[model samples]
Target chain A: MDAIVVSRLTKHYGAALAVSDISFSVPAGSTLGLLGGNGAGKTTTIAMLLGLLLPTSGSIRILGHDMARDRFAALARMNFSSPYVALPHRLSVTENLRVYAHLYDVPNTERRIRELADELDLHELLDRPAGELSAGQKTRVALAKSLINRPDVLLLDEPTASLDPDTGDMVRGWLERYRAATGCTFLLASHNMAEVERLCSDVLMLKRGAIVDRGTPGELLDRYQRDGLEEVFLDIARDRRPEMVP
Target chain B: MRPALRRVWGMVYRHLALYRRSWPRLLELAYWPTFQMLIWGFTASFFAQRLGNGGAAGVGVAAMGMLLSGVLLWEVALRTQMGLAVGFLEEIWSRNLGHVFVSPLRPWELVAALIVMSVLRMLGGVLPAVLLAWALYAFDLFAPGPVVVLFIANLMVMGWSVSLGVVSLILRHGAGAEALAWTVLFGLTPFSAVFYPVAVLPAYLRPVAWALPSSHVFEGMRAVIGPDAIGPDAIGPGAILWHELAWATGLNLAWLAAACLLFAGQFKAARTRGALLSIGE
Candidate 1:
């Protein structure tokens, strides 16, 4: 079954269409990369899927539960992450994770916490408050938080936007392994073409609230006759739509 | 229900840790309220003692009545204001509101965490303010009796009432609502019957005062400590305490329910139309 089914989702902010009618689905255990520049309605789409933003029209079925009416069912099995938001700065990394651990009612809390800490290299920072951590450390903590519950549906926004290359590569590697082990589904929104190319099995390029193009990384590269995903993104951002080739 | 409350407790723990870590800034935040209470309490108590009836401790219970209830009303206003300002707005400063909401935490859990933290602030500051008063005039800090319980309940409801109103305003606007919250409070203070008795209010404004839950707080507190005691009768052992207790309990419940409804509507508006997240995001 598809892990996420967004059917013609539209979000209107007064007269401005933040996310025009758009539709897509993510198969369980697969990854879909949502690539867009600023104001491309990327966050809006992610928010709607998370039930953080209500759609003006259409429906969202996440994990086979209707988001509009039965969001709790989906939310219970789902989680999201973004570096822009943070865990309480004053709480130690352990404290922050403990809160979420209790929140999800994760059984055998200590074990799960230890596992995530070891996996995320957070043991050294466990005693430090989350606010005191550097940007890279914060990203790791957030990643640990997102994985705390072993979520079935994981939606991430710019997961590695500001990370140093090494740290970013490590996080990407961990996500890949985590998904492989759990067969978890993922919807990643990022501007990092390499990350998208490395991780996403499919790509959806958005422009001004609409899906301007979509394909696998190689397919998109071939269709745009471009050397890399970066050139393809530039072509789309500069209003250079690729011609369809049958 | 237990799970939900546990979540709130977890949030409280985190909040306490944050406050401890940021003790410097937190102390600064407490500075204004601490000073406000002492200055206002001393000045009000002085006027009640001299220019009015009995000077300082010599004044009749009428003076005690005004001063006691004034302190209680300020407690309510300060909690409600800071819950919105200090507690909720802290999320904005830390840029953690989005993370909080996206977690397993619900809206009520966050609200409870804010209110409880606000109450703890009272625990830290209220005694010191009362002690300062006790030092000057030698009034017992604990002399307020069961009325003190009523005062705390009153403050909780008032916090809920004002926080809901302010949260609603935040949903429609953004940080602009901060100035508006204080502005609304300043506009409503005189109308709140916080200083003088509600009887002194103008005929038309009487309805306005009656509408505000804080007015009832002052009335209820004064009923216990005033010259007439429980009623037109005398102090009569614990009779005054019982009467004040009944009114505070009943009115606190009403204010709580109303506050819940107000926040419910605000949450609904927030869910749709991009209200929960700040505007222009």
Candidate 2:
């Protein structure tokens, strides 16, 4: 069964079309990279999937439940994380996690919080306020928050955008292991090509509220005749076709 | 706990955590109510000494007591509204609304949590003032006995109704609507007749004053403070209490229902427009 299915997903802001005629699905346990430059409707898409925003027109099915008709069921099994968003600053890390745990109706909240804290290397920071954490620490805490419910599907928007190389690599590894261990499907919206290449089995490149390209990393590299995924990204971003590029 | 209640508990805990860790936040909860109480208490004392109650029975003490009661009870309206509004504003400031909404937390559950937190916040601010009234002026807010319960509950419900309306505006317009949180209740203060009787208002404005739940509450409060407390026009305490309860319940329920519908509508609009995304940004 697919963990996510979005068809004809569209969003509008007054005269502006934020996302137009987009469709895709993530197979269970698979990772799909959502690649886009700024304002490419990546956030809009994710918001709709999470039911935080309503689509202008589209249907979203998650884990066999229609999101528009019955979103709480899907929301109960799905979680999203983004470095751009944050937990309550005055709240301690443990307090924030416990709050989400209770919202998700997770049993044994203290036990669940401890397990996530240990895994995320947050034992030392558990008592500290969330606002005082470094960028990397905040990123990890956000990731921990996303997993507090053991969601079957995880959505991440620039999950490691502000982290140092070592911490970013560590988070990527943790996510990879997490997906492998739990068979949780992932939809990652990220600008880090290396991270995407390492984690996403398939990639969908969005530009101007529409998908312009999609393929595996190897396929995209071969098709664009580029040495790296970043080069391929640049080619697409610049709107240069393969035949036009030398 | 039931799942819905658990969700509400989570929201309450989130706000409580902030209050727990920040001394300034805790201080804010009590500062205004206490300040208002002290100022009004002294003013009442001055009035009681100067006016000398006009040779009426129990009128001297009632004059003194009414001021303290007015200030403390006004807080029931202020604190409850602020409790719900401030908690929501904090979520917007922290950029945590997206996280909370994306979870299984429903809108009604969030409002329920805010109501619970508002009650706590109301007590946190008003209790200190009540104690201060007793210690300094020997004025007991509960002097009217069980009728005080009806008076307080009615004022709180009306305050909660206003709170829900302000939240709806914020959800639709973002942080720009925050000033309404403080100003909206004050807008009704003239109508509430907090320090004076509604009969004192201009003939044209009396209907508008009567329309407010707080107006009825203040009128009822005057009756309980004794007929001579609010000039010559005060009704008897027992009859006014029952009348105030019925008016307060009916009007507050209607207002609450209207506010809830407005909030729900704005919430849906915000979600569709992605207004929720731009809240903190």
Write out the backbone clash pairs for model 1. B49-B55, B54-B59
TM-score (C-alpha) between model 2 and the true structure: 0.97
Error of 1 at B147 (Å): 4.1
Best by DockQ: 2
TM-score of each: 0.88, 0.97
Count clashes in each candidate, considering only residues at least 3 apart in sequence or on different chains.
2, 0
Docking class of 2: high
Chain B fold agreement for model 1, TM-score: 0.80
How high a TM-score does candidate 1 get?
0.88
List of clashing residue pairs for candidate 2: none
Give one digit per residue, the lDDT tens place, for model 2 in A1-246.
Answer: 788899999988888999999999889999999998898889989999999899989899999999999999999999999988889998999999999999999999999989998888899999999999998999999999999999999999999988999989988999999999999999999999999999999999999999998988889988999988889888988998988879
Model 2 CA lDDT for position A14: 88
Query: lDDT tens string, model 1, B1-281?
Result: 37687778767776777777777756755565557666666776666657455333424445654665476457556645565446776676566666666666778878888778777765565556656656765655346575666566666667666666776677667656766555665677786666767778889888887766677766655655544432344443323545444655576677668767877787777778655555324
Worst 10 residues of 2 chain B by lDDT: B230-239
